[model samples]
Target: MKIIWTFTLMMIPGVVSSMSVTGYSGGGVNITCEYDKKYKENTKYFCKGDWLSCIDRIRTDIKDKWFDDGRFSLYDDTRSAVFTVTIRNLTEEDSGTYHCGVDIPTGIDSSTEVKLKISTGQQTRTVRGYSGGNIIINYKYELIHTNHVIDVCKTSSDQCFTVINTNRSTEWKRDRRFSAHDDTSAGLLRLFIRDLNENDSGEYKIIVKVSEDYSFFSEFDLDIKTDDCCVKSISLSASAGGSVNINCKYPQSHSGDVKFVCWRSGADLCAKETPVNESRRWRDEGKIQLYDDREQQLLTGSISHVTEENSEYWCGVQTDQGHKIFITRVLVSVTDTVGPAAGWPVWMGITVACVTFIIIIIIIIVLYKIQKKRINCRSAIDEYENYPRTDPRTDPRTDPRTDPRTDPRTDPRTDPRTDPRTDPRTDPRTDPRTDPSEDTYTSLDLNTRSSDLYDTLTTVHPRPAVHQ
Candidate 1:
């Protein structure tokens, strides 16, 4: 149907509050608005845009009956004192401001604005399950539309065929293969499909009815695969001294076979090496253990205290006596103590703390020695300054020749050069140059006097005070 979505109404006032609603392109959305009980019998309408230039799309005067227009519908539940407006086949242009209003006989209508946002991209999800297994898918709806019909369908090129629906019962089952359960309180629809085969792999969708012509949908892709003897390869890592589990899948036909694990080394491809076979209970061989879950069709091999020796292994099945078929190659690596599941080991922390403590001790010892050396140097300098030293040139008491009090020659009273009375230049009577007549008398005395008397003559007269 060609739906015209725009129509103008008279400008109104008194828009109190607003709400937000979200929908996807090509999907539908429902908006539930609450009103006072006094307006239970009043006409309720839904419109687009703001109050000044609002365009009314659909209005209903009858209570509890849905009134439909092109792409829009309105229903007023008088008992609940609320009105619901549903918009179908939403497009990008339909996303804008809308209003849920009740008409009055007086001043203006009572309305609450709604902001609708339509996403251009459709949300799709993917799920995978093994053949002969079961899968469960869940979808949620708005609380107001929880009681509406919910259906699960498988899609073809252009159409979808309903597999199960909640129209007949809230819990519906079909052909023992498809089932649906609608949880009203949680607003969840859960669909279950069991005994999955390769043919069950396809695109499926969930449809939630909002109105007679409007419905919301979400699509998902389901991939189902047939079981092999085991997976091709698996890579796992575990911290050293930790443990790991290697799970291998097999077909139901080999569920009765002897499941085992062996080391794959050099050129032996697990043939020459002994296999750790499964027993009735968990059987341990060295560090590895094997367990067969017949009901789950799985062979689980567990290695404790993983090391480099546990690096390469294989998942095998012994169909004939003394013959094994290695199917999956498992490559394991031993990591450090720091890993996602396994945190740092206790020994590592202790080692780091010990090294840090030793370093701190060494630093303290070095600092103490430096401080001691500085103190010793300061002490030596202080001792040198306080020590007594003797100098003959400065201290007269330290040397006898320079001491004037101890040496008679250095005394001013005994020294003739320093005493004016003992100097002949000061006495003219003893000096012969003062009296020339005394020169001949002095020569006669010098000629007649002995060597001892010459000292007395030289001492008595300074002899004109010779410069020598």
Candidate 2:
């Protein structure tokens, strides 16, 4: 049967009048049609269904591709008198006759018929699993009277990973973690993989016996999720020179075997430095103290006088007496105690600033008003003092003391001091001799001088100077 099937496939397309092709349902196939050189420039086409009358079409001269004709495609090369036809997503209904034709202006066009057979089989179904879990797969079919042999092989090589048969007495055998079973009456073949792992995910080939020498194969893509153990982290805040207490606890599990702790800076992973409990304690007692509380499943560590350098720390929990554990990153915020102002709430600080600004604005407005009023009053006083009421008494041109005469030296009666006519003291009213009361008082005073004054007066009055 194998030799006959191979010979049949090798004889395809040997004759130009007709050919036969094979395709898998839900798969694709390509076929080539040859013609005489004289039809190279003529119009070429791909026609589907009955050769006498076809519905699906692609014209070579119009554009050589038939992409819009459903899943059918045709490419015509006029220079070589050859056309290639490609079909995709084949179905059982697509198994029929198809024509590669050339258009002739006169009479009917010549064509070659192609017999297509679309063989369909079951596709491999997907199965998923996580690490540390079991996965089961069934490869079953209808019961048939043929020798039943099923082999599940990895696609990477031609080797059976697990095999199942109806004749073998020792049927179920285990290889690695894989096992298989066969139910001949129900046409069922099942496979089970215990404790699936990440590396088990890949392409697997399922091969089955269709005949004594002929068989079919399928493929499956398996994907297994990785077992993830995420490390958790936490944050803490403390003042400088203060002590901090840390606790690491986890959910209840199969074992309360957690008994260790570690600490580190910068990176978040803990560094286990303490020895077993039977040995001595950690020598660095002043800075750190660690304890394990089995009753409460609590692991505690205390750090004294913590500074900014204590910012990065790692706390961890052990799930077993061995090295299996999980860690958490610790972030400590070490700050200083500021003054009392630093404790003030946000709203209070804003309120005080607003009030101070308002008071300053009011004071500035008051001072500006007072200064403006002073400047206005001084300006009014200066304007009034500048124009002294235009009084004639102060004018040099109109006052009597200012004199109407242009030249005082030309005045006719000017005195020695101011008068131009006579001596200032020669006025009879100013002379003592002209005053009768003045002569009486003067003649009586100093009797001896009066006698000489009277004799001189008598000589002047009597002797007008005898002509001498």
Candidate 3:
């Protein structure tokens, strides 16, 4: 059994300072040391060991020296009075005590000491998460105050672009990959890393800048996993003339596999395929970049100058035998660069649509109310038109006059005795001659006939005495 023990160098005296750096056996780091202004023009050298018999591996002269020895590079800045040394592709034998010293004319020269520890980290803690999932790493060390500074980095390398400082709000927020929360009460700092991929798997260091008095360091290892298929379908939206980068994941076992993208028609594959090496392949109009990362087993692609005319394409990989195996279908929607309302942005168009919908509903409601009001305003005369079966004769106002019985056009007068000539309604019982229906002609003729007959009868009675 092999046991590895690490010790902190804070126990050393003589203006004491120490920093512990942890890294993987195949990984690298950069060491930075600060000095007083008096050491500005002094020659800076990096050595491996205690002050006495330390091995002089590399040195720097006073005149802005830059030293490069393959895996190691050293730079001494005379103005800042600081020197930095970078080591790459390290191994277990490379781990040891290192010191940054300056050649001084006076007494014992000044130097800063640090310890480098290398391990495969098989004995340390680890975590696994999906490609698109998030991971929370907890550091339980107590903090001095809210002012405690913390930085999370992929490696111990100095000035690495992957270094994210928690003290600066914008630095962590700007990078979509990282976020942090400090729980002052529990003395716990939780780091949230998102949009993870296989490349994110590695050793990570946590640095705490407490004060000029001392500094603290902690390390964690991550082992990110993926689903069985590794890659899933992706849908992307962009504006006309914009660009989009598509990333797909594969297992490390599938290294050197041929990646492909082609147009698709329904369930059938289109004959035309895009060539990755060519600058323009997507419908002969898109500029594309294809990169295969053997270490991370990730294939990323970028399409530039995409318009709405660019459409459905399949992203896939070829097997060792060169058979195409599609993993995901890519749907790219390039929207109109200019919105419905001229010069308006996407949000403004959405707002206008909502407002338009509301206005339509209000207009419909107003029209319904207007129709109801017209129905309520109808007069009784108009309502009567609905009943066509009713008889006008049954109505007493057939003449539509107030008094039908004594109406001047119908009866002329109410009383006939007033003036017979003016009163067209004079009664027949009042004057016999005016009774045309019964005795108008017969009444005058009967009287004359009877008188004539009686005179004739008297004369005929005397002449007829003998016949009697």
Better of 1 and 3 by TM-score: 3
What ranking of all candidate models by TM-score puts the best one first?
A: 3, 1, 2
TM-score of candidate 3 to 2 decimals: 0.33
Global lDDT scores for all candidate models: 0.69, 0.57, 0.60
- Clash counts for the predictions, in order: 0, 7, 0
Per-residue accuracy of model 1 over 1-468 as CA lDDT, tens digit each: 112211112223657556666676766676888888998988899888778688988987978777778888777889989887877677889989988888888858888888787776444466655565454566665566654787788989535798888883654445458767788887777676766688998988787765542456776788777656557678998887676778987667666777777774443344234343444467666667677887888787676566676677767566432234445668888886745434333344458789999999999999999999999999999999998878866766677676777577768687788565577775657455565435644566545767765566556654454476
Candidates in order, TM-scores: namely 0.32, 0.27, 0.33
lDDT per residue as tens, model 2, 183-223: 66766666666555778888775555443323444556666
Residue 147 CA error for candidate 1 (Å)?
19
Instruction: Put down candidate 3 lDDT per residue, 1-468, tens digits, no spaces.
Output: 112222333333222455666545444566777778777877777788886667766776745666876777778877877787766666789889977777777766667776787655222245555565444566655433455676777754444235566673422232466766556666566666655688888877665555442344555577766667575568897667666678776665556666666665432343346544322223222355566665676667666556665656656555432334445567788877733343333345569999999999999999999998888777655878776564555665563564557675566464445657555565554443465423323344644666665465444432123343
All models, RMSD in angstroms: 25.9, 28.9, 19.7
Deviation (Å) of 76 in candidate 2: 28
Clashing pairs in 1: none
